[model samples]
Target: MKLPRMVYNQPEVVQPVRTDVLIMSPWLAPIVWDGTYNLGILNAQYRQRKFRVGITIFAIKKYTVFVKKFIESAEKYFMVGQKVTYYIFTDRASDIPVMNLAEGRSIAVLKVPSYPRWQDVSMRRMEMIRDSSHTRFSHEVDYLVCVDVDMTFNDEVGVEILSNLFGTLHPGMFGLPRDSYTYERNPQSEAYIPADEGDFYYAGGFFGGNTEEVYKLTNFCHKAMMVDKEKNIEAVWHDESYLNRYFLYHKPTKILSPEYLWDDNFGIPAFLKRRRFLAVPKNHDEIRNRR
Candidate 1:
């Protein structure tokens, strides 16, 4: 698709078309994979808003069956004109029935070289986003979201949130504020995560951006992953962690309330839940009800 070229600090003459959010699910049976159900819920929510939804599935040859089923199910609920692109990355030609359904539809299949392990397969997803951002839109998309196939949306994320997050004074990574108790040890030995400096701990599984910023962030992640590859660190979840630190130091990602990207195990405090307009059943059922 041809997207408008964006100039920093300069308003565009034409309103760039906001393509559907791009979600990556790299696995054989993605629906049954991590956060797959949640992704379905979130995809349904996006379709409800009439937003175009494009999904890229990274899987092996045998797993094409499940991928086809997942795409068909998504198409059932999505609006008629709403688009869904299923970019399949695999070694051999796909035997699944996806191609039969894809003719004359927005959906398309792309077969890529196979990777050693399924976990290390995210490289394909990274490449897809990078290529799309750099070439397709000229790196000028309104919001290029990269969410794990597992995350579910509880509320409608309208243009308002995108405007607020990107237009706010603090334009950086938007995610759940970090808490001292649940902090995962920072993997970057060279990079020190200051304790108590900020309230947000970014969740990599669900994060997006002003397209330009996201491009930069993902570019950084790709480079970092390349380094890891050289160092023999095969599956480091580099994309997620790189994004967290990139915004932490780059400061383009605005640190926002945790509700935007909530975690059931470690998330916003009970008292702060309502304050932030976030609802978690466990937190509400246990923490608020007790009070």
Candidate 2:
């Protein structure tokens, strides 16, 4: 692919972008944040490739109410100008709302059954994604990005996030000591990480990789959940626990800062330049039917 001559400032190796936050991981992977990379350069590089990105989101039962807002906000902020296919997994396809999507963006509904518990609903995503990756996602898209449906985009989530494999920092878990990280501690479950072991507790709400890497990840997590089920053990945080354990060993090619996955409960800190994607405030007991 011939990249046309374009005027942009040459990157200076001596001067770093954000001195406060860790710009690079121990493994040399870039920790993405605002001011880290030039969007013009990234957009031109990726847009020329004509990449196909498929984002997976699940809206089932009570979660259906979040669909319209998610789609509307997504249309305004997510992967603008890229070929995006939102593979929405929902029990009730009719309940999924329709909206005017932008050019090169569309939606595909994958009908699934509703789970009895909200925990099951969240944990089952690994299995659902694994199966879909094998039969559908692999052939349809170059990359698979997954996110929780209950959240909405607040800022640009563009090609800057695309990588061979990527994980977002858990908003509540960041800036805390490793010991304080809520990694699964049960030795019996496959999601267990030893007391002294952990890199970063990742947000399961958002993560992705190329088709092959995502397949390998979801496959491992799904099978681990099955083993725990057979032994009558469930990890403390469901899919998120499994995800943390996986990233601990596997490591991601790129890591997104907390800006990509902030909780609605917390105020945006001064250090954060962009509040990209955020959790929509909701009552846990009321929405999940915990009552």
Candidate 3:
């Protein structure tokens, strides 16, 4: 079933009833939409429809512990009343934690090969998701939410985020000027974005959309990375740089606030009173270097 397209702007006099939507940046890009969404209303609207939503995560090697915490938090807080499926892509399917899911929620474990380097693991995720969306997910789910396993939900994460295409503002870069964004600057790479052009630097850790749109995004990123591989030109931030490039040309239908993917290690800012999911602090040296 096709979802309604979200209206970006309304008549000036009508006034936005939702105060969580922030217009802070000089670019005037709608960065955060926290209180703007009423999940109760959205839940009631979609609950009867029984939309099949797929949440995909990769937890190779040491990341298994994180997956456990993520799923625990997700089962309790993520899309609580909706029809949701956790598509866990892991090298060790046996490591997936067994949990009692709510009535309409379930888990699907798919085995993937382990990679030696974390960078390769991150880059290959795009290819795997793209291929699997066609082979596995498209047949089962209507929408797909791809996220990093290192985070856990702290509040409601429901249909408010659903759109034809959506991306979350990188909490670290949302306050920076467009030119300060860490976009791929090299002219030779397919992910290159000029310093002057960028709506927002979206986090690579979380993003989602309808199954078909997400498949297109993943496929595009995978192809771009391959082109960079041939030229021995890796973007400064790997797949993330490619994602920023993609959204610059094709703006997302909805832009989630940093609240959706915050880093608790950084502490909450004054403007951010509520954080939906927090990235638990991890010893990057240990997790990434061990592999």
- TM-score, candidate 1, is 0.50
Q: Which ten residues in a row have the lowest lDDT in candidate 1?
A: 27-36
By TM-score rank, best first, the candidates go 2, 3, 1
Tens-place lDDT per residue, model 2, 174-249, is 8898889888888999999997888888999999999999999999999999999999999999999999999999
Instruction: For residues 152-203, write the lDDT of model 1, one tens digit per residue.
Output: 3444333323311221111133323544423324554322345565434455
- Choose the strongest candidate by TM-score: 2
Question: lDDT tens string, model 3, 102-209?
Answer: 998899998999888888899999999999999989999999999999899998788888888889999899778999999999999999999889978999999989
Clashes of each: 13, 0, 1
Q: Which of the two, 2 or 3, has more lDDT?
A: 2
Off by over 4 Å in 3: 1-32
lDDT (CA) per prediction: 0.43, 0.91, 0.86
By summed lDDT, which 10 consecutive residues of candidate 2 come out lowest?
282-291
Cα error, candidate 2, residue 96 (Å): 0.8
C-alpha RMSD for every candidate:
13.7, 1.4, 4.2
